[model samples]
Target chain A: MTRVVVDREVCMSAGVCEMEAPAVFELDADGVLQVGEPTDLAAVEGAVRACPTGALQLVD
Target chain B: MSTPTLDAIDLSERTFWGAPPEQRHAVFDLLRRESPFAFFAEPQVPYIPVGPGYHAVTRYADVEAISSQPALFASGSGAVSIADMPPDLNEFYGSLISMDDPRHGKIRRIVAKAFTPRVLENLVGNVQAVADDVVARARRTAEAGDGTIDVVADLAAPIPLRVICDMMGIPEADRAMVLQQSTVILSGGDPELVEDEEYMVTAFLKAGELLAGLMERLAAERLERPADDLTTALVTTEVDGERLSHQEIASFFILLLVAGNETTRNAISQGVLALSEHPAERDRWAADPGLTRTAVEEVVRWTSPITWMRRTATRDVELSGQHFPAGSKFLLFYAAANRDPAVFADPHRFDLSRDPNPHVGFGSRGPHFCLGAHLARREIGVAFRAFADHLPDLEVCGEPARLQSSFVNGLKRLPARLTGVR
Candidate 1:
């Protein structure tokens, strides 16, 4: 299984990850990023790559 | 390897920027091939004192590397201008783009609350509506007068301006004023816009003051009334018991107006020019609207608006086989990097469906990567979709009057002839 992890310190809340994989990544009202279990590994991977700040990582 | 003679290349000359696009690209190609990490004296603009020269980071890989390491290559000194901005101007001009981490991240998080995917998803409907209205108005103007329309003034410029103004709850009466001030702010020292080079600094300061004043007034009003718009959200929203002050909000507002408004406007303007130049791609997009996604990226890649951003070395560093001491400046040339043959095959060619198109048009993958990238992409997509659906026969009738500044890839006027407006 591939897991998604977010480095809150690094994330700038650009919302690129949320836009790419909304199901897996969300930005709450306060702009804090919330990570969910990755159901679609491909989309999760894409979101990790699309992250502007290199804040998201995928671990297998 | 022989030492590259840079006699033929002079990035500091303003005339070099105003030259034809192909000529400029040829010079960049020569630099990239021979001197990927080249240095040049700064352009001598009026009022700003010149300092140490900057390295021209022309390679795609180097731009990406430098962008990713904000600690190593900091932007706090200044990111927009080759010359260091005066301390007074930093109050208004020093927004997140010119900031490094921690401070940059904190403010960005607050601002990002207003640009969440949910927030932007709601904005899509508004953007489409604005695009349609702008296109319809352009058609009416063309029909009432000659078939020709200045795409920059009449069509491309209005859509983003209206969208950004509406999002901020700017009064209808003040929309034109906002557009004018933003134009001057990002005019890139265009002779047509600034007129007298001697007062160029005055022009910039005046534009910044006008925009900042307008935003401060609106922010005060939002504080009292609490309207349902970005202005209200920005004034009210907080993170970790931290809220943006009026000064910070005003500066960010000015940033949005100049960065969000001017960049998207240029992208739309250049999109029309690119499509008109490549009729086959235009027809293909017309036939398959699905290609709007890829076509939007292609336009950004081809145009590379907001040409270069300046980054300074925080510590002594060696990159791409070159050593630079601390405080050395590097101008990451996005225009050159986007067309880098090593990264982009036949980069000069405009291919709409080019996938994995990791063009650094949006400042690459970094902390300071454009905050408005999603909005810009949506605006361009909608504008082109409008063109394909309504003005399929539109084509460039004459040459585009390109912006004189090297910073922003902008068009002052794009003469376009429209027909078959349905």
Candidate 2:
């Protein structure tokens, strides 16, 4: 299983992560990055890479 | 195949600007219900013969599919509007949006270097300072004369325009001219900006030329005398040991000045309008400042600025039972998608706490997604915060004079009182 970590300080809520992996990551109502239990590593990596702010990270 | 509901939609040249959102939404709903993917022949103007129209992608899923699959549904042809841009205009005026894969990727990579995370972080304070200044200026205007602030010119418009100019290292003297030209470029046959349809294309072409020339001069200036600004950074910065040429820099500047400026301005102005309309949501947001982020997102969704972007089909494709040929155009209706009742509950209701809102307001589905999205969101949040804190009673003093352009869901003049009026 993989977990998504976000650098809250700089997360501009571009929503790229949510778009790339809507099932695994979301910019919540409070504008914080909320991670989902994503089984797909490809989708997770794509989200992390797509983030313009480089705020999203993947952890095992 | 013709459906009665599809026939009800009046998507003509006159339908975009000045036509209320209700009418637009009605058409969108009908399209989504009857023809989620259907042929759309734009209403013809006098001098302009109707081109082979487009496939209107109305549903959220179809829009996502089209936007995500840029290869199949390409952007380089007619990026912003319904009409196909001439090759010269596509190369020059289209800039980032006008190119397909190889070119789009190259330009995006180069431009992304200038708009780094550090640059975005720095924009926070700049946006805040500009927001505060704008609010103060609006307050004074309100106090000076019956407590009314035209939020578009006085509040929303100034911040984005000034910030974009500031970011690009444009002198204060030339910012006004840049704003004027970009306005004309996107005026969309509005009489206030141009005479009529006959001169619309000419007006767009001339505006693009003027901005390109101005930016060429600025790029030269930055090359000679480097400064701590985006323009200077773009002129000097390299990505993978590749630097942008003068033309690319100029075109990128045009995109920023035109699309970037208008998006934030409309989001903020319409945001104010949304709050005014939904007093309950407004009160909730004002009462609890923590929801500013949610409020900002709601505002963007409500406004849905930059309604649609055109994509040219590269090959024969099928979406939601509609077949599109290789050369056919597709107009992704983001405004309709944002308001898709299938995705959102009570889509029209302005709920500040609407969670899990994957709205395409800033268009995050593809490479052409707004590069300035984060900055725009922050500006909206910060501007709203300024009003909530500084003027707790702030509300719309009069109905906004909506801009007569379909491309941008905008307000030309938003009569607002920083202090809520009786």
Candidate 3:
């Protein structure tokens, strides 16, 4: 199983993560962070790296 | 164009145009601490009464929230400036940036189709070449003079102007005029740029006409002879089986030319000033080419180039604990939020290595986040890298001459030295 988490305190909500992996990350119209379970670990990691805030993390 | 001195003016005046740092930062700092959400009246315009006033959203979270909910805090009402723009100007000036979803989304997607990842990745080589040429010219001037150099003109301004021209396929003969008109438009009523206080309006109108005419010509040329450029891409790309008309292409050109040229140039000019003030960080960036990336990010954060944009409340909405009635105008102060202590540690310090740096210098999230961010970042990074490689020990030679507007946090002049290289 794979899980994702966000630290809202640091999240600027730039939404780069969403662009990298929209399936796993859902930033709202205003740019709130919403993480979903990902079937594709590669895409999830891409988002984790893309996040300027480092707000996204994946744990197995 | 006439700016009241900070000492002589009323502190409660609630104006940001050309105010000194002590006064300008005071309001932003106060708003971030006490009234993170508050209302202030727009400065009185010359001809007719414009905006009634606007609620400021200062906190980082509040900016994010407002940006996310564009539907609630709509952009169409007045996206260009806080002053209510006359309808004709609004339609002419407003492109994807000022529209709502469906339309905004569609236009952005069609535009995005032109800016493919490969095109951007390909631009890196071309961007670096431009950076090299820019620095070479600057070095020649520095070595010949008393090391006196106007970084804003000799160094910073050329990079973006060249890139935008290259990207848009603008004719070389017309590039000089486009730059001249844009400078006047974004100069923000500086007496040096505009004839008088009232001429600012006409200046912008004339500038708009100049750029629109240039774009329409380019659009027509690109259609006749499709080149490997954004103009050709804009004309050819179809959305839902519909292509962009000549007018839509011109609108995008106006948006891209102004936004692209001004933001990156200001960022570069301001970045030079910041680095000169913080030499240790400058040395750090110069020592390692890899550090240029982060340094560029820090500069963009430090100088929120686009300043603030206005959004109208579609319905009665509460933001940052303040109740805003429907039709209320909300100003998202990216310049303020970029420095909020809650988000950035030691918010005022110019730290190049600031991790988790999510400054909205490019404007925050939402469908309207800056489309040229990738290209802008590349421009800043490469330009700074070349500066470091050639003029590694540049120091401030004089005080910066700032632009006269609240909208673009621009540096009109920056005097610097090439140090030993001179």
Query: Top model by DockQ, which number?
Result: 1
C-alpha local distance difference test of each model: 0.86, 0.76, 0.77
TM-score of chain B of each: 0.96, 0.93, 0.93
Among residues 3 or more apart in sequence or in different chains, the pairs in candidate 1 whose N, CA or C atoms overlap within 3 Å are: none
Per-residue alpha-carbon lDDT of candidate 3 for residues B156-230, written as tens digits (9 for 90 to 100): 888999998998888789877877888886776777788777767888888988898887777788889999887
For residue B117, model 3's alpha carbon misses the true position, in angstroms, by: 4.2
Ranking by TM-score: 1, 3, 2
Q: Give fnat, all candidates.
A: 0.85, 0.00, 0.00
Tell me the tens digit of each residue's lDDT in model 2 across B1-422: 33236555656556455866777787788888777876767755444556887777789998888887778988887687677656766667678888876767655655654454344666888888988888887777887788777878888888888888888888888888888888887776677778777777778878888888888888888889898877786778664677876677777788888976888888888888888888888888888989986778888888998888888889998876767679888788889899888899998888888876778887746677777776787778888988887777677777777777877887888776655533
Top lDDT hit: 1
Task: Return the lDDT, model 1, position A52.
Answer: 83
Clashing residue pairs in candidate 3, if any?
Answer: A29-B68, A30-B68
Q: Is candidate 1 or candidate 2 better by DockQ?
A: 1
